[model samples]
Each structure stands twice: as structure tokens, then as C-alpha cells.
Target chain A: MRMPKLTAFLMATAVFASALVASADEVHVLNWKGYGADEPWAIAAFEKATGNKVVNDFFNSEQEMLTKLRTNPGLYDVVMINAAFNDQAMAEKLIQPIDVSKIPNYADISADKAGSPMLARDGKVYGVPWVWGLTALAINEKAFETPPTSIAEMWNEAHKGRVTIRDDAVEAVQFGAIATGQNINDIKDMEAVKAKLTSLMPQIKTFWSSENDWNQMVASNQIDIGTYWSGSADRAKTHFKLPVSLVIPREGAVAWLDAFSIPVGAKNVAGAEAFINTMIDPKFYVEWVTKVGAPVSANAKAVAALPEDAFNRKVMGDPGVAKRIQFQAPISDAQREAYLALWQELKVNVK
Target chain B: MAGQVATGARSGLRSALPLLVPAYLWLTVAIFMPLSAMVFFSFMTELPLSGKAWSFTLDNYATFFAQGLYRTLLLASLKLGLEVTLWCVVIGYPAAYVLAKVFRGRSREAIFLLVILPFWSNGLVRIFSWAMVLREGGILDTALNAVLPFKINIDLMYSYPAVIIGLVHSYVPYMVLTCYLTLQAIDDSLIEAGRSLGASRLQMLKRVIIPLSMPGLVAGAALIFVPVVGSFMEPRILGGRTGTFYGTIIEDQFVAVFNWPLGAALSFILLAVVLVILALASPVLKRAA
Candidate 1:
């Protein structure tokens, strides 16, 4: 009376392999941190809708992901790279020109979400936007009598030995320049950036390397304020039950997007398109953002269906917020070397 | 004494040349070849590709000298290496002595097996196991928190002290094994003869037992100190980004920083430091023997 589980298993295995060996039934994907890990709803829906298994690999940085895709010709079906890297990936013939006709759910995504740097390029859609966020000043209201307003306030004498700066070169250098009203994009102006940083360095209790770090410093009032990503700031608030306000500074901010695109060598074109379509579903998008604490740019109606407070608190919801922020593009290889060299110099020269 | 040692050494070498040649060849191919490549790259601003060598430049050398990071990190590693060696020497000597002297047959094997338990486990896992014990809100913290009336939670992970502790824990077994071998090699009759001479318990240990153990102590110190100086992980995990030793910067330059030439130059600088330490240590070893 019992159906054979082994038969079902064999069928599933055949389908999975054909997706890899053949080109139609499996979606080979690459995405960055916190984006591609097992999301049960997305996986189930994608499989059911398209009869495709979503085979995914994760990359930590845009540099690594882009480099891998560039060096390897046709290994991946779909790769999620930032808008900045799309130029190189195109120039190198690393990515396939995405066929929007293959992906139908692309129509459902609104104008605002599609306009993200990673998804839209030169009047053509290359990818779909996933996570868009800004690095900001996280203020612990419980620690301070009055929380500071902007990035500059974090380095004020009152916050001495209580402010934590991120160890990231881009965030530290950009926030330093932006807080002081300098062009954050100009890497050549090291003296101006260094001057601002050297002044602020002493005020910083410690430089944080990982997002998981600085929780104790902020929560326990050892550090009253710090440079933090929105997800981290929100989690700190939720975990410690502290009134942590994630503040985007007056002097511009940094915005980044993780996007998915098919690589040139992709074996499973149909499956990849199916997976991308599955990700765009309003119901799936709503569940992902709510669970993951990252507001992915998706269907507005789906996002609106969430609780009012949760929707409002979603950092990605503010249009003006994104406008003020600059997204990083892969600088020319020469400039990248220069930036790293300069960063090394900065680390040595500063405390 | 020098002449005697030289002749004796020559005889020993002649006898062991067949065994020594294979080891020497292995060391050259495995270690020296890579080392020479690094040294060569240190002098080059850019690496040779397609059988073409880049123009030799000392920018890496200059960076090493100018930034003075090499010096600071080199000095930090040296200080930590010495501390780690001292820790192993202090802890391992007595433990090794107990294993060799007090325990015998099956009991000795069990105790020695206990010492080797950590060795059987992966080095990273062992260090992490210690991290689990020592880190804040970890095993030790929970235990202390339960017993202590106040916040006596010792924030052990991401501290220099924790690294020193981890280094000591990770490599102490090597020190124990080295010392135990030397202790075992000592004839039991010599210890008896010292006792028979009516030397005090302390005198017997100092005059007879300790002199024989000097070689083990020195060997153990070398094993612990040299590798610990070049260690990257223990310090990085334990220190966090608050700061790190010299090794971390060197690693970042190669892997993440993507400046192999600079990293190579730093490697040579570290190698020089190692050579200097070994040169300094040679005299102490000679005197001990």
C-alpha cells in the first residue's frame, strides 16, 4: 500500500542531474552573503512552479565573485554580482546578456526596485535586485542621555572611548570624508581623508572587523555609538532590547546591492530563469525579508502587507535614503591596488 | 673540547650520512625551494610570468623599512614567542619529568597517551575547544558566573593572554614529548649514584638530573618558540581586529591585499629575525650542553 520513496528519489536525482548536465531543468546560481543560503519557501516555490532545482553557491565579496566568473568561462548558470562588476563581467564576456523574455516575473517588479545599480545598466536590465542597504551610525539610546545626530557626533569628546569605528577601509575612509563634507569617491585625496581619520581615530574605542563584533561594546554601554550596517544595528536592538536607532548620516551614505544574473557558460538556462522568477513572487519576497531582516526590493504590495512598524523600520523602504548613498563599483585594477596600498599605509600610520 | 666534539661529530655524520642525505634533500625541496622563491620575489617589485623576470626593485624592502610595521610586528612576535617558550618550558618540563620518572609501564603509557590526546585532535579544533572554554559567555564564564556573586566573566577570547594560552596549549605536547625522550634516555644508575653520594634531594636534581635534561629543555624551547613566532591563526582569532601580530599583516598582503612582492619582502624580514634569534640562541645551547 506504500509508494516507493526510492522511485521518487531516483526521479528527483535524474531531474537534478539533467539540470546540471543538460541545460533546461536546473538553475545554477551564485549570490553573496546572507542571500543564497537555504530559504525554504523560495526553494519549495521555485521547485514547484518551474520543476527546477535551484543549485546555488555563495561568494563573500564582489571582488572574489567577479574574479571567479571572469576567470572561468561558462561554469555558472546564474551569478549574483553588484552593478559595478557587471561592466567587467560584460567586457570580459563572462556573463550572458540576460533575456528578460525568459523571466516573466521581471514585469511584476516595480520601476523603483528595477532601477537599482546592480539590476539596470545602460537602458537594459542585466540582473534582478536582492539586498539594498546603507552603512550607518548605530546609537544606543540606553547608553547615552541623548543619542548623537550624525556621523561627526560619534567622534565628539563626550563619546570618547565609547565610539567604535568599523575596520573596513571603505566605510571608515568614506564616512570620514563624507562626515567632513569631502567627496567620498576621490581615493587620490588621501591627505584630506587621513586628516579627518587621524582626528577621529583616537575617539574610536576599537575598529570592528566583523559585523558580529561590537555587540558587547554597544549593548553594555562600553561603546555608546558606532559605525554599523543596518541589519547589525537592527539585530542589536532586537537582541538586547535596547533603543538602538540606525541613523544614516547627513553627509551622504553607502548603498550596495546583491543581484543575480546568468553567466555565459551556464548549462541550465531555463532552470536559472525559473529560479529568478520564483524569487520575484510577492508572497516569497515578503516571507524572505521578514525572516532575514533585510528588506529586498520587491513587489510594493507584498512589502506593504507586512506590519506597519516593521515596514516603516525597513531601511530599504526610504527612497531619499538610497539617493544620498553611493554604491561601490569595482575600480580599475590599478586603482584597486592603489587603494589597498594606501589602506596599508593608513593602518601603519594611524594608531 | 672543540676538537673532540668536531671529531666525534664527523664520525657521527659519516655514519648517519645515508639517513641524513634523504632528510636534507627533503628539507631542501620542500622548504628551501619555496624560501628561495620568496627571497627572490622580495627583491622583485613584480613577479616573473611567461619565463620573463620583472626588473628587480626594492619597494617591498623599502616598504618594510619605511612603514616600520615589520619591525613592530617582528618585535611583538619575538616577545610573544619568548613568552610562549617560557610557558611551555615551565609547564612541560615538570609534566614530562613526571611521565618519565613516576609512571611506569601501562600507567606511563596512559599518562603519555593523555598528553598525546590533544595531538590526535586537529590543532584548530583544539584551539577552538579552548576558545569555547575561555571565551565570554562560554564554559568557563558560565561556571564562574554561577559561582561568583558578580560579573566575574573573564573576556578571554580576542585577548593577547588568550593567544598565549592557546599557543601554550596547542604546542605544549610537542615540548612534553621532546623532554620525555631526553629524560627516558638518562640512565637510572646515574640518578641512583647521585642519591648514593649523599647529595641532598635538591642537589641530586640540580647537579645530575637537570644537566642531562638541559638538551630536552633547549630542544623543546626551539620547537615551541620558532613556530609560535610565525603563527597566524591563534593570534588573529584571539586578538581580533583590535590588533594582530606581524604574521597577520604578512598573510593579508599575500591573500587579501594581493601584493605578493610586498608579502615576500616581509617574509624575508621575518626570516632574518628568525635567523637572528637562532644565532643568539646557539651560544646558550652550547653552554647548556
Candidate 2:
């Protein structure tokens, strides 16, 4: 039994070794599922124009991406990471500085969004904003005739078994702080946050990790209200044909930005730059945002090109919408450790 | 004659070396080296790979003892393991008995194959399939409601029970396969002998058949319990809000918190617990063997 398996393994290893040695003109990209160059047109058009094939790989989180880049050097050309992780990525030198000159489309970014600290370090641009969205309440209109207006509704006894919260420690703790009338960014009393999270345990039917998890819960009528991403809400409504809509509660929502950057040991720098430029093209952004459902575009031309009834225009054009949503901010490792500890306590106490 | 025998034994050893070396080499590279590395890393304050300034510390293990939450979560995971294994035994043993004893000829072979068929598909996909069947307005609900006179809510998704159901469904096949092999190996004449010696049906089952199949029960229990203790995905997908366990926290350390040292320590602790359980069970297992 083992002899046959051993022979087969040896044969397979020989095949893979040869495959790795064979050179190809391809820009290997590492990103989140369904993100940049994952679109057929982006890959097809890039390959047609640049004569470089696109290879895509994905990770579920920034930490996983960082680990891959650190461990598997030269495996990926372009990577998309959360804006909040730019400092750590730079400090570790896992990613290299961006050559803005090579990417002419860098000028397409709006001044306000371009000022993000994640974009520049030591006066050198590192990454370009790829997509941005907010974590807010996604309610099924069929379940809620009047949309919920506050994060407090997540704890309402009336909807005890219909509420789904995010499973993320930072997001859950931040929202817990927000629900208890504290600034989410500057959490002073972790005990208070943990207490708040513990109190809401009875109300949550389940905790979801991904946008697809939230969508499935709502689509199947398993959950009526959830802490969901705005982009996911749009996708769920269109794809699942569910009566779901995203509403930023009175306590506000956490906004996050993902940016494209070149890894330190990229073999195809020119191809990687071309891919990023192609991703930010106004025409591409317009079609990308509309079809894929992004909350907003960082590209000035793309933002201006939105139609009157477009999802981004309606959401981003609202007065003080940008101010109301709290952008993703970096936290000290000590704070992160403290928050994780409290999160453990909250989870353990979830009887 | 003694010198010739010694030369023959030496040749036998040389012949076996080629096969034995590969297996031991594989074990050293795959299991032993990683375990040693994990142990070494568990003593560090930070990851050594990043070339960041780091120092040796016992804080990772210390933190496990410092927090009551970790202890509680470990106990909960152990309880979950027990619950799942017990359910597997309750559900799988009867099916194994039916297939081995009651079913005959072509049907027995087909039924045995059908019992283990779910194992062929992806475990993750099978777990997710249960989500579809157990969720609100799902297949089970729709089917039951269609047959019943009165409408009723039958949603079981996201609850603790759903996690148990999904795990049992996923692991029951292992128990069935193990128990079936042992049950089939037991001579039917021995069971008949027990019955002919004034033993009732229950006595024959409890005395002759069950004692003979103890090895299979122990083997299946060990198989199910070890993985169940380390399981995170099943709870996450099926348990919903109630899914957090020791395994998930260990997952969070490596993936979410970027705390490799702490994760390693936690994993080591879980390994110790599993070793202790197996050690305690070894006596009974030896007797059965």
C-alpha cells in the first residue's frame, strides 16, 4: 500500500520541480478573493496589451498575506493588503516602495484619499488605494420595515435570534466600545468593551467571518440583521435577491481601505506596475465598482464618472458620510494583545 | 553454522534498511522537526524569522495559566470532543452491527460502501452542506413542514446542537468503518455458543459480541476524539455565535493575532492533554487487544 504511494509521490515531485524551473512572462498577484486582476477583463486586457500573463493567488486576511510574502519570497509580484498594515509591512521590509513615475494612473487618485498615511512613508509612496468599504448594519427590509438606526439595536431583545455580529476581535471590540458610548479608536477601558460584548451575546444568533457568510445567513432567512460590509450588502441584494440594505448606525461604522503594492522580491516589476495602473483606470473603475459593488473609489476621475443612481454616489455623496465613518487606524501591539485577551474572555463567557 | 547464521542476519538487516530509513526519515522531517521547532518557538517572546529583536521568555505559557478563559475554553473543547465521540458511538455502532450481522450478500457490501461514501467528498464541503439542511427555511424544515398538518419553525442552524450534528455526520463514517471490520471478524459461532449456553439475546450481545469488538470501539474513539479536540472549522461553520473553542483561539493566535509563540504554547498544551487521555485509555485497549 505504501510502496505505490511513495512511487506516485516521487513522480509528482519530479513534475512539479520541472514546472517551477520553466520560466514564463507572468505577473503573479496575491490578493483577497475577487480582488484586483481577478476580474477577467483586467487579466485579459493586461495580457493582450502588455504581453504578460497574470497569475492570481488569494489570502483571507492581511496577516496571512504578510506571512506568505515574508516566507515565500519572489513567489508573488503584486500583493493587496489592508491599509492599516502598511507600517508593519514596511517595517518588516516585506513590501517595497512604489515607483509612482511608472504608474501614471497614480495621479488619478483624489487628493483627500491620497493623503492617507498608508500611501506614503518617508515621503515615498508605497501603495495605491484599490478599494474601500465600511462595516455597517445590513438589515433585511422584509424583517425590518423601519431600518435600524443605532448599533444598540444589535442588542435589542425583540430580535434576539435574528442578529449576526462579526467574528473579528478588533471589529467586535470596537463596535462594543461604540455601543457603550466610547470612542472605538481610542479604547480606554477594555473591561467595559468586554462587558458590552458579553451583554450582547444573547442577542446574536451567530457570528459571521466573511461577507459571503453574512450574505448566506440573510439569503437563507437565518438572520434578519447583521454587522455587514456595505459592499457585501450591495452584492447580497443583487446576487441573492434579498431585501437587504446597508445602513450606517448612529454610532457609525469602521471604514477600511485595501491597497495594491509590490512585494520586495518581485520578479516582474514592470508587469506589476502595469497591473496596478490598469486596476485604477477610470473606465475600469467605473465598470468594476458598478458590477463588483465597491463603497467608493479613491480615483478622482472614477468618483466623478459615477452615474446619478450609482451605489457609490448615493452612499459617498451623503453629507458628512466620509466624516461619519471612522477609517481604519493602526494600533500598538500591546493594545492588540490586550484586546485579544478580552475578546477571549468574551467568547468563553458566551453561554 | 553460527558464523553463517550471523552473516545471514546481517544481510537481512541491510535489506530492511532501505525501506525503514525512508519512513523514519519522513517522520523526522515531517513530525519530529516541526514539533521541536514549535517547542523552541514557544519559549520565545517573538518570531525569530522576522529578524526583529527577540528574547527568550516563558510569558506565552505563563499567560495560559494567568488567564482563566483559556482553561475554560480548553475544558469546553474537551467536553465537545466527548459529546461528539459519544454521539458517534451511539449512532454508528448500530449501523455497523446491522451491516455486519443483519445485512447479507450483495446488500452488505453495497451498504458498507454507502456508509463510508460521505468520507470520499471534501470534509469542508460536507460540513457546509449541513448548514444548508439545518438553517432556517432549509430542506429539512421545508420537507417536514410540507408533511405536517401545522406549520412550525424547525431552524437548528448556528446552535450548539447543529455543531454536534455536523461533526457526528462528518465523523460517524469512521466509527462505522472501524466497528464494521471488527464486528465482521467476530465468529458468528461464538455468539451462537453464548446463546446456546443459556445466555439471552442481550447477554449474548453484551458478553460475546461487544467484548470482541472492544478494539474497534477504542480505535474509533481515539480517531474521533483527537481531531474533534483540535477542530475549529466545524464549530465556526455550524455553531455560529456559539462556535468559539480552544482550537479557534489557537487559530486566532497564528492567523488573526500574529502570535506564533502563544499559539505554539496552546497547541503544545492541547497535545499534552491528548497524550494523557491516550495513556489513560491504553490499559483497557491492551486488555481488549
- Top of the candidates by DockQ: 2
lDDT measured at residue A318 in model 1 versus the true structure, 0 to 100: 71
| Worst ten in a row by lDDT for model 1 chain A | A1-10
Per-residue lDDT tens digits for candidate 2, residues A1-351, read: 112223433453454354342134788888877764698876888899999988877776666677667766776788887888887888888889988889888898877667798668998878888778888888978788789788887788888888888877888888887777777778788778877888888888888887778777776767778788877787777666878998888777888887888988788888889988888888788877767766577787777798877667777557577767788777767778777887777777885
Residue A8 error for model 2, in Å?
20
Q: What is the lDDT of residue B89 in candidate 1?
A: 83
Model 2 Cα lDDT, one tens digit per residue, B113-141: 88878989998899889988988799999
- Candidate 2 regions off by >4 Å? A1-28, A50-57, A68-78, A93-103, A262-273, B1-8
Top of the candidates by lDDT: 2
- CAPRI band of model 2? acceptable
State model 2's lDDT. Answer: 0.81
- DockQ for all candidate structures vs. native: 0.13, 0.40
Give lDDT tens digits, candidate 1, residues B1-289: 3355447767775776676679779878656766676678778866452122478887888877785656777788888899999989889989999999888999999989999898888877877677677766678888999998888857666567888889998889988998999998889999898888898989988898889988888888888888888787787666543346677677666555445677777777777778887898799887986
Pairs of colliding residues, candidate 2: A206-B241
